[model samples]
Target: MEPPPPPPRWFQRLDRRLRLSPLGVAWTSGREMELMHRAMGFAALGFLTLVPVLVLVAAAQPSSGHGFARWLGQAIGVTHESQLQVERLFGVPNTALQRTTAFGLAALAVFGLTFGSAVQTGYEKVWDLPTARWHTMWRHVVFLALLVGALLGFVNTPAPSGDVTGPLTVVVLDLIGTFLFFWIAQHILLGGRVRWIALLPGAVATTLGLLGLRGFSQLVFSPLIASSAVTYGPFGTVLVVQSWLVGVGFVVYGGALVGRLAHEGRVFRRLKDQDET
Candidate 1:
């Protein structure tokens, strides 16, 4: 077949303009990953599997009397009224622990492994690595254990609402904790195929994204929870929570995608220049 004709000047200019910018590069990469769809999948799998496991983790914590519901409320930055609604959803920690059984825990763990697998797969795609083998289930297990631990730490950390330093303290702690978790998580899930330096940008990006999401949740979901509960009862509240999960998924994957482009410095180069290099 004959080679395709060179692009028109206008077309070339438009392409060059987009490909040379970081935002444009992000847009392109996001489309390739079907980023929104991937985020939805992350949210769906995380909700169905990881939430149950986290509930158990919350139940197991002696310090947290309010249980998984409290964790959920804090994560989404809700106010006291909204947090109360959430506590009602899951009941108290003792109640949650009372309901737990060996068989039930095992089942939740098995399902939670799938959530870890999904996270691993997301990392692989971001790095363009081949899928890890079935034997790699051990990594998933470890990842899940660490995840539970990280969350437990978050749940247990006390940030008194009335303290002047409470908000600042939480911000600093969240930044450090989130950074370490994602940086280590990428190493673990990628099986260390990627170097720490190359993965650093992704972790930073993901952490910033999470922080931004937390801020947004505080402004939006905090009030939404109270109102939604009144309008649609528990189901409305559930919808708001699900929406937050979707945002979380979007940030986790989208941030990594942004970081990959940044690492390559492709965001600084035009498409034709990149091709030549």
Candidate 2:
């Protein structure tokens, strides 16, 4: 593999402030990269292994997923009955199995790449190193599956709630889960070893960013979607796509902030020593 290039002169100049960013912490902490790699492998494995568990748990309840789906569809102007039909189409025993398999495979591919990219980013930052070969990436993939499975089994177990609150809660939880997944992916990509507490800062930053985006979207875009007559049509699709982009912007910015924080911390420490002298 080729040696990773050093950061450009501009980034180097801002290195102190960057340490406080997620990317900076990732870059500075080689151990974290290794942890991230391992955790990613475990997470993928967890996705496959936990499908049955999640399905079983979900199936046992009989009413959880459909309820949420129904409520979402209605809130979005999709009639409750239309939502029910969609659920039924996917819920047949055979169909559900196939859906689960397809979902698992897709997740494995999506997150495998996602975690790997994060690892590559961190590896580049810390050591000026490039990613390892596919074999190395595979090792990380396996590690991610395991790590993610454990986490889902623990933190993500569903709570039975009929109250089914607002769209904002749904959006918030979705973003929170996304942040957690990315945080864990970073841990796995690094090597499945990190201080769990180290994850909190990144998660906190990400969640806050997501919430802010949510508020902005509600204020600026919700009415446009709400006022539309088309449900499950091209107009609705466009609205959903637009909202997704807004959310994604927040997530990407949050990640960049993570990188910057780490860079900043190192610069601060170095300067403090010079000042002492």
Candidate 3:
């Protein structure tokens, strides 16, 4: 077989720089990019299941009041103007809505579970463990419950009005909530394979990454949403949301990678000491 071709000069330099930096070490060692791609695939699946549920719920409500849109805006901590845009985007006629049924809910649950399962598999791969199946259903159920709680917390907490404090409070709450969720998720999804302390770094990283993305969305997605609304109408909302999900997938997986690397480093040190003795 022919030997592989050499990497490009730019890539070689970039790789070397990554090797030198601490973050780069984790990124490379943890196979962060590859994991991110896998995560995006599953996250997309979750988004597919999730969006329909949101749409159905929104459509079932009276569109005249924009009640669903307003709820969603509160859930994500967006401003009033953004809330109106969301209302315009998601507000579907009641006549077109499908009734929520047991079968539909079951299917959504299965699809939504796949994303968490995928993340669990990714962490298992990182830790060099066999695939775990025991208690898998229960774990997914717990994850779903946690997700619902987080959403409820977000939507129920009113954003302070008419001052910078409101936005700051929103950001702080989002950060804290995300941190707690990711931290808990790391523990539950991984099935207690690693200590909680080992998971903190990645949880923190994921929280910060999410916060950064939220800020980026505020600056970038608002205009896109406005333009898309004018151009593609309601479908544009779907496009924007899917795009956001892709970013979220990367952050979620990347954080897992970071945590895995931390756990591995500790294990490596312990092994090395044993060898020396």
Work out the TM-score per prediction. Answer: 0.87, 0.47, 0.76
Expressed as tens digits, the lDDT of each residue in 45-130 for candidate 1 is: 77787677666666676666765676688789899999988887765455677888898878788777888898888878877889
Model 2 backbone overlap count: 65
Where in model 3 is the C-alpha error above 4 Å? Answer: 1-17, 29-33, 54-83, 92-98, 262-277
Clashes of each: 0, 65, 0
Ranking by TM-score: 1, 3, 2
Point out the higher-scoring one by TM-score: 2 or 3.
Answer: 3
- Per-residue lDDT for 218 in model 2? 49
Clashing pairs in 1: none
> For model 1, what is the alpha-carbon lDDT of residue 187?
89
Q: State the displacement of the C-alpha of residue 166, model 3, in Å, after optimal TM-score superposition.
A: 3.6
Candidate 3 clashing pairs, residues 3+ apart or interchain: none
lDDT of 3 by residue, 89-182 (tens): 6666675455567887888888777756776776676656688876666887787668755754554456477898887887687789889998
Please list the C-alpha lDDT of all candidates, in the order they appear.
0.83, 0.49, 0.71
- For candidate 2, the per-residue lDDT at 222 reads 48
When summed lDDT is taken over every stretch of 10 residues in candidate 1, the lowest stretch is: 263-272
Best by TM-score: 1
